[model samples]
Target: MLKEQFKQLAIGVAAFTFSCATAKAATTITVAVTPTAANAIVDLVADFVNANPTYDVAVVGSSDSLSKDAIVAGGATGPYDLLLAQSYSVPANLKYYYPTLVSGDPFPFAKDTLVLYSTTVDISQGIPLQLQAFSLPDPATADPYGVAAVQALGPEYLYAQGQSLTIKTADAGGSYAQVAYLGTAYGFTGKSQICTAVTNVDQYEPGSFHHEYVLGQDYTTDIVLAGVKIARTRTVDQETALTAFVNFLVSAKATALQHHCYKLPSAQ
Candidate 1:
């Protein structure tokens, strides 16, 4: 009877040990993404979790400038394991972080172009005079789309007419929302945002809007969407999980998913 009790105790101890090991093997990776890519990142995370059942993924979406600031300041150590930002801003903003917060070079995943959006404009008639106010992303704050939008309004462009334009700066998502639902007459944002607005009009403003490609005339400025991995601030297992997630983001499947919202790099 004593031997039987010892055998049962050993079995229980072994089972508990196995459970602990399994729990330790499971990892969670957090990703910080720009507001423009929020929806697409959510979908990509869902697909990644499906393929990697042992790993859990979380996504936080914010402005490009804010996201870069968080990672560079080491605020992302406990919150985010990776960051997705505009390619134009990455090199300049992330250079200081180096191998500590930023693992390596940014991987270009997609591209976006600046465009004009309006709910009350008749594009067939060309630039309208009633379009007095414009919503744009803040170029000073590291928004490449905003910079492109400003370039599109240069003297060389057709819209550089004598009419004075009122410009309001906002983030990518905010810029889109201003045109789609906030009753802004003209909004400047990425073409991908226009695609998102058109694809989900009913879900957003439930109204008709027009989008025109204005930046094509000025190709000096381009927007590329890229992803960068955060430094290994967590356990080695967690670092491996984070690396895997970043690799999956550049995979063909992930690129296809990104193309649904933004233009791919190769498509440029």
Candidate 2:
């Protein structure tokens, strides 16, 4: 009878140990996100945080600073458990930090399309009064949407234009009125940048004329609200965690992307 009791006790201890180990295995990942799309994914992250309680998020920035440079410069020292960068912004300089996944592609979370815009005054009769006159963002190092926007404007036209109306560069909070009043800025992102610019212009121009053209993918949204110009982006290293997050976003109860004016990626 004593031997039987000892065996049962040992089995109970092993079972308890296994359960504890399993519970401890669950982990939360941190994603470094740009501003344009962070709004959307943050909702999803909130749900994950609420459900799991162990996970947390730290938003980095919307554009420029605190982006690719931070990730590349800090490498593993950066605060992120995962890096969310533009498809174009992925720094070749930090190739050493990324790990290869055996079978899955980097999950695309949102998209933003850059547009060619002018203050409302620039438009008369619903057409641009300036007649093919505008400033464009620099394609080489700025936003991908901006780069593509410049390309959409055509190389010959861009080269021949003599670069007038170039808005001055300013930190993120320079106020939209300040940017538009500068008249020209070469580098820009998509909607957020333009929106900021418009806000600046509106302060001064008030009903300023603005026009926009779709530049390129700024963020990849889930399929539901995919039409919005900007969407957040993020990636995860753990396949299980990544899959769980994806599923959570798509799930009916936590349809965070759809709620945020962006669509989720189509199921594959």
Tens digit of per-residue lDDT, candidate 2, span 1-268: 2112122221212111001011233343445554444544555676665675544433343343455454445544444444444443343223324432112334555444443444434432322334343444334455454345445545444553565444322221122223354443222324433332212231212444444443233222211111101112234423355456555654654555444323335532
lDDT of candidate 1 at residue 154, scale 0 to 100: 65
Best by lDDT: 1
For model 1, residues 202-260, the per-residue Cα lDDT tens digits are: 12122445455544576457677877777647777788778777777776657534434
RMSD of 1: 14.2
TM-score of each: 0.74, 0.53
Model 1, residue 106: C-alpha shift (Å): 1.6
Provide the clashing-pair count of each candidate structure: 0, 47
Candidate 1: clashing pairs of residues: none
Overall lDDT per candidate, in order of appearance:
0.60, 0.38
Determine which window of 10 residues in candidate 1 has minimal summed lDDT. Answer: 12-21
Candidate 2, residue 209: lDDT: 43
Model 2 segments more than 4 A misplaced: 1-28, 50-54, 62-77, 91-105, 122-135, 155-163, 168-189, 192-243, 246-263
Model 2, TM vs. native: 0.53
